[model samples]
Target: MVHSSDVCQCESFIRYEKTFGVTHFYSIEGVPRTGPTNVTILNITKHSALVKWTEIAAEDRLGFLQGYRISYTDSSRKKSPAVTLNASVTSYHLTGLKEKTTYRVQISGFTNAGEGPLTLSQPFSTPKYDKGELEGFVIGVCFSMTLILVFAPLTCCLVIKR
Candidate 1:
């Protein structure tokens, strides 16, 4: 199901850049302004980092904001995967980070116009891995077992008519 709000306002035209010649144009709309006036790393877990940020002022958005591109780098690679998020979303969790590793993060927005400014964040490191001990493992198994015990009987009764 699609909603009216989800429908985008778009147009098509060929425009020439100052340096480059005419470029292909299709489905062009207004684009967001410089993204993320403030890029903050809220928390750094052993294998993840939680990032939060506020968007640029509305006036900066020349066109409607479609979404954002969040990128960061760690020790293993010079570049990280770009995560695309909705414009309304102001926070995100970055997973698969290395333990006790620092990373440089950047945030940019995209609109009908194109990609906006990239806000490079200060280097931040993931937290050291802490052995959670048997407490977490035991609790997880117990929880799974409880659910299976409760559902297994109902599933068997429905499947095998005795």
Candidate 2:
């Protein structure tokens, strides 16, 4: 026998009838209601980048938080390997990336229940090679070639005169 008033007043509950009798289960366990906030990229470089985000609020995380999941894709739309971070980690450093390429990243919180909704993908571009270092190498090579062109002929003429 069951009545509306007899139901447990919990945030969430389940009721069922077994072979023996009626039973009720109550639990607050659920996936996070909202994704991480303030997702930002920093310290972008030729081959690496740093990503950070705010943690899900306590009230929003309905279950025991286990960790976070990060997914990224490059401009070519190829998905990179997803990363899972500890619950205490609010930032991550991505590595082994191509220079001057654009990437999009998304983050979501996971609990004992499952992964929550993902944040909108955030985009960032890696920096290209440094021009100053390349220019210096080119200049050094040109100077060495000029010296060889001038000195080689002079040395040959002196040897012929001898």
Candidate 3:
């Protein structure tokens, strides 16, 4: 039985008084015991990265699973808004990232009670963008193809007329 003063501001938990004026806490809706595991961050491009992780085990999720929160920041320590995904999501593509930068990402699950603990941050690095190299390769291929197309037909005609 709960008394008037026994209930705390957060209804999920209650504080009750015992003998000798001692207080004890009890949980009605427990949060997850641990964060998600097997978190992986892979850089897919200079401006984006892919994040994937396994969900928290059923036993650890003490309440209804709402979703997962992903927090990421670059080496400069600039804070970015966290992305929240539904519980069904296991993979996410993070865009608008800086090129050739190192970033750290952390993941955690949440429920009606609140967010659970965050996993250890994992580091990933984006590759540098070099447009010149790609452009040069494309231009070279187009030029070689144009030359072959022009010369091959003319050579066949000349040999047939001989």
lDDT, each prediction: 0.76, 0.86, 0.83
Scored by lDDT, model 3 comes in at 0.83
Q: Which stretches of candidate 2 lie over 4 Å from their true place?
A: 1-26, 130-162
lDDT (Cα, tens digit) per residue for candidate 3, span 65-155: 7899999989999968999999999989999998889899998999888999999999988877644667888899999999999999999
Decide which is better by lDDT, 2 or 3.
2
What CA RMSD would you report for each candidate?
A: 16.4, 10.4, 11.2
- Candidate 1's residue-wise lDDT over 7-102, tens digit each? 233434224313334233334455564677777887677788788888767667766778889988887757987999988998899988888788
- TM-score, each model? 0.59, 0.69, 0.65
In model 3, the worst 10-residue window by lDDT is 1-10
Query: Each model's number of backbone clashes?
Result: 5, 0, 0
Alpha carbon lDDT at 95, candidate 3: 92
Which is superior by TM-score, 1 or 2?
2
Q: Put the candidates in lDDT order, highest first.
A: 2, 3, 1
